[model samples]
Target chain A: MVDQVHKEFRRRDLLYSGALWLLSLIIPDPQLHYRREYRFRKRDLFYLLTILLLPLIWSDPHFHHIMVLGGIHGILALGLTLFLGYAGQISLGQAAFFGIGAYTTAVLTTRYGLPSFLAFWASALTAFLFAYLIGRPILKLKGYFLALATLGFGEIFLVMVRESPRLTGGVIGIFDIPFFSFAGFIFDTYLKQYYLIWGVLMGLVLFSKNLIRSKMGRAFLAVAASEDGASAVGIDVSRIKLGVFVIGAAFAGLAGSLFASVMSTANPETFSLNLSVLIVMMVILGGMGNLYGPIAGAIFLTYLIDELSRYQEYSLPIYGVILILLLIFFPDGIGTRLRIRLIYLISYWGRKRRREKVEL
Target chain B: MFLSVEEIVKHYDGVMALNRISLQVRKGTVKGLMGPNGAGKSTLFHLISGMERPDSGKIFFKKRDITGLQTYEISRLGVGRTFQTLQIFGNMTVVENVLTGMHSRIRGGFLSSGLYLPQIKKSEEIAIKEAKEILELLGLFGRWKWFASQLSYGEQRRLEIARGLAAKPDLLLLDEPAAGLTYPEAKQLAQTLSRLKEAGLTLFLIEHHMGMVMEIADEVAVLNNGELLAEGPPDMVKKDPGVIEAYAPRR
Candidate 1:
């Protein structure tokens, strides 16, 4: 009897999903309705409120430090999503851009005695220049060839940083990097640093949200969908690719500059092929092509890594298995899957309530 | 002539795809290209649109030499084209696909766009308004927000043309726009094409449906084995011996 009841329930669930799918097809959900009417979404408001209240609720310095790291990773992933996700290009050397930024900040602030504020912008400029120089040639490649080419670039950056001790401190890394300060106020406390990183992140998020809906964003989507079609529509495919690459590099650079100051170090080990792969993994896991997906992925992975530390050496294997499972189930990304599930749940309840009313 | 191709030649490996093909498109007229398989109709379109540079030839649009220009450069010169295969951005909504075609017409810097400056917002509003109009013209206004991939095959073809038209091109190149359309859809497409011609838009298309081509095309050019066989009014081309022989099925 119990088995039969379970089967009936399963059948009802399948029927509900099928009806929902069909309904979705007939009257397509106009996702922009809210954006057109209301400037802010409920989810956006929720995230803002949570971010605003997090400091008061989470007073632990260790948690604050980890969250700061998550914010940095969020920046890196956000930049990379523009290149790897939006432009539909493969990049395995984004960490090189990150390294370039960190080193630029490190060298300028330590050697030239530049202020952190000036060094931050300089780091972005240096990374942009580096991306532009290499992007012209590298961006021409597609698929695995592009991935390999970027990986090679990252390896070259690693070797150069390690070999140049006088400039980059030779793996021991640059130290005593001054904290980020603005107009005589120093971000000396953990709370200050947390706000500092999150503030930058929020600004970038807002900027990216606006960009993804703009004309250039449309061009990026066109290129990503079909290069031939994009060119046919008067969008310079190569130029767009190069532009996204440079922009992604600039973002990485900004994050790296903040990272150098926050962590008070610039080391070759921090920006490695492993870290590059980790960033890519974060993008894949968090979801590609959405603004918040990569950020969520970064935080999730950061927390996961921290929690898995108790597993000692076995943590790596466990983490790999979990990633494989995540990809299998939510290949589109956790954010998209969750969004779809939420819609389905709401529609299912609506249908059930309507059926109950009809029966009455 | 609004557009002219002079002795265009294109080769792939050891095979010649287009052999010294030259054609002219008069302003505000519908010109149809009819050809057998491997007759290089699509190849000629690609060359004209700058998808690939012809091995040798000169193409002029509005009397400007556009032979060596890039595809986007050619497009910016008021040339819009739809591919033989559907090139719709499947993930994007139908309206967004059309809006993307209006890329060159709207001007806003990266910073301005990212910050959603007032000028950028105005441009975006205009873009949406224009896109909706184009979609309505294509009979896709109701489905503007639908994903391009989810549209029916006929709608997808119409969406491609809608996207091409959204660019406000002086010369539009359509490759096999009615290949998968139902009879009614093809008729609708023909009507749309006629309306576009009446609106003073020049159309150059490649098609296999002779009935639709003969009915809609002001002039038709027939190609056989990568060579232009005949060019004349659709009625005269229909009676041409070479054109019939090229299209006739082999037993």
Candidate 2:
């Protein structure tokens, strides 16, 4: 009898969990869709079906463009999220790294007449080196100090891009940059660009997701929380900080290269301090420290800006209002709030079902 | 000797934290270091743990000179320590925090661990099992999944000990394990210490609670004003006039 009861309880738990997993698949939770739900929880067959069908739906030209831009922004946001969210390092120089990748790709393809494919990898490498050198001293400082240093870095990169005419083509920008090609297939249309960007984004997301669950990722979290405590437990806080910074910047650089290739241009206006601020805002508005939060922030901000272009005079005010509301209502960010609500609902329903079964 | 510290001197802006402090611990023996506050107990612990390097000293662990070695390297040499102020990964669950203590045991790098390779998975499973067992031993198994910060003050202190124990170190240095515990809690901690001693673990502890220390400590060394005042068996050290005088109420 006891064995039967225990078995029944286990069966019920499995059933309930299965149902919740199924429900999560159908629900369109913009914030919790990626990180908490899909990443950690076991997805049902329907979710797997949807994943396979997503590429087919993106075959349209307009949809493909939106998808490509989304992919680039997603990669950039994910990279920044790792540093600002998980590792607790604030970086306002992400656009600087992005600009570096763009210029590097442009100069290599247009000025040096190099293949666009090689330029992408070169851009990533250059960004990594730049981050390593700059991050060493800046990462040593915390909070406001670190922010100030990165801000200075952003401004310096912007100025350099503006002043260097021969190298960067100044404000008018570098054009006639070669398009990205993979295995001799040039990414000429929105459809090709979508597939290319999506492929890169997927690789980054998977790599970063795996990285967070590793020992190195735990060391980063430990250092972020308390440097002295982390040291006491045998973690090299400085090295971990530098490692995340470089990796994050590399991701930004990759996004920049893609952006440059898609537009066939590199310009100072494209990598402004305002763009850096926008990236930071996206990270914050989505949720700081959450892996998927930035994706939601990026998508929402992008679509909102695109839609708000109808009222050019009122767009800024509307954007400010939305940000203020998000800050006041869901301070932990939409991702965390949605996760908490889902967990609460699940547990509540579980208890109600238990009560009904007991009554029967 | 498994570990030795010789003529360690530390000065913070001419304020002597440790003046010619020296100690040794052999394999398979527990050593106690008792000292009043500002008597350089923590400073000495820091020096041994490699949190800070002494101005002049030689520290040897397992016959290897470890002077100026990093904290992580010192820990890797099988010298684990607990903080006087509770140090724990607050954001992580209790089990995760304990697994962190077993970090050095897992040889696989980030990629292997991240990919969850067969060997890495096996190691992680064993680590979780060992961590669970440690928590059970400390009577914290029920709350294993709770965040470390959610634990009560006494539980947090015990969690710190559990984390240190999970490292499976040859020598464990505990700094004031019973610092803020109630009398009953202190008594329970004494029992835990006795249990650990029976397991043949070498423990070097700094404590101010004389009652608890005398109960579990086989040998005691007392420090006052950055100098060793007494070192002997618990009974002898308890009755020593110098030990009593050093701890007596200051007017």
Candidate 3:
């Protein structure tokens, strides 16, 4: 086993390129039939390469830490992107699921001595179970009612945590949680953790991208377009809504578990409405329905928060003003404006060439 | 009896929208449902498509009792519907609109699709192939990548039918398909409906355009005052005094 490990651990680019080749191999080639849909394939590949190579250039431990944290938030935001952006549903209870994940890992690892890997999965499962239970009831409500119900559920989770002092550690929170490990390799350093989190994040983004282009993904968009229209096409709108909601919860759980392992703590205060609101804002600011947008939003907002901390007390007000400005300027999404502009430019070029041909 | 609605009654806020309306659409025929404004044409469509429950009635498609089934369930049972107001997914491109309409035909769910399983990839290829074919039939295949919102009104209406066809439903219920079409466009639409009828699909459509309905429908059912006023071959119904009275009303 040691020989096998050493043999495969030769070089980074070789492994990374091998991974990319495998990804390319699995990227089902219906692009010929969907020329327009696959228009951004080259750009996507570029992004993937950049994500893989980004750590080498930015080796600052602090930079890695911030990016690792951003990646975690990015995963959480990606989960909500599928639910809220594609399916056009509202959820304010994402923090509750995140909290569930953290607490699940914290309790299992601390008291029962469960391994981080198993506890991590266990956290996701627990959150999925909870979302399944609550989603059916809450997803029935649409619009602001759904939002309010989710908000209430988040509040209830906080209350439950505070009330269960023995289990949750209540106000003081749980500490000294072990770092994440799998098959004996510990993610103890910020650089290692950075790769780990971003790796997970990129996988999820790929999964989400694959999903949105598939039938079920289209059903989500249809539901967002019009419930009656979705039904007209044989899509079960409510069921799709519930499906995305649970998936989002599971994502939050995964994020939460990672948070616990990295921070080495779990607390009730961390999974509050503010976090939930922040995730929603990330989705909004990044752009809904576009997978990369929310993750970008998460990373940008994380860095923004870090940068603004220099202002001390004035950071929050400035943050609020900046967010409002972003929303106003990029209503569709941060990337949407750029994409639209690119389209306009391309069309303008096409028109100019056509006129030249006509003149000739 | 490929599709049947027996004594379907519906009302809204003390108004008798459809008073015990019973209708049947035979296989491979274009059945036109015509009525004056507020004569319950759309209300009956809502009930048949399972968008709304009838106060009392039974609806059956392919011998399955679908009276109170949810809209998607009824749709899965091979009933596709289009709304009086356009219900196109405007955000999606033309081919995507049709692909979404093929939801019932797709068996892949979140797990299979999100992971892009090999089977899902194969099935999706076939589905997209079929979607393009449907668009080809509507002459919108050339603009398959254009957003639904970018299509002109006539083209959008045809795109709606293209989406309906993508579902490959046995019986399609189109509500007010020709509501806002120009005369030439309506003529083209009538030809398209006639072509669809020849393709062995059942159609029960609601339309206000008398000429198009008369030209394409194998039979016409006229509704007036929440009651069946006339039912016969198009020429016979067109000549019926009761139908003429209800439509013109001596006004």
lDDT of all predictions: 0.87, 0.81, 0.86
Give one digit per residue, the lDDT tens place, for model 2 in B101-139: 777786566556546567765776788889999999888
Ranking by TM-score: 1, 3, 2
Please, what are the lDDT tens digits per residue for candidate 2 over residues A1-360?
657656777888898788666656544343432222223444334534543467687566766666677678878888898888778889888999999999999999998888888999999999999999999888989999999899899999989888889898888999988889867889998877877887787677667766766566666666666666676666667888888889889999999999999988888987988888888888887887666568768877777777787899999999889888988887877766765677678878878877776665
What DockQ was computed for model 3?
0.59
- Tens digits of lDDT, candidate 1, A184-286: 8888878899899999999888887777788878887788889999999999999999989998999999999999989888999999998899899888888
DockQ for every model, please: 0.65, 0.35, 0.59
Best by TM-score: 1
Q: Find the number of clashing residue pairs for candidate 3.
A: 0
TM-score of each: 0.92, 0.87, 0.90
Runs in model 1 deviating more than 4 A are A1-39, A342-360, B249-251
Model 1 lDDT per residue over B156-200, tens place:
999999989988999999999999888999999999999999999
In terms of docking quality, model 1 is: medium
Candidate 2 displacement at residue B202 in angstroms? 1.9
lDDT at residue B238 of model 1 (Cα atoms) = 90
Give the residue spans of candidate 3 off by over 4 A: A1-40, A339-360
| 1 versus 2: better TM-score goes to | 1
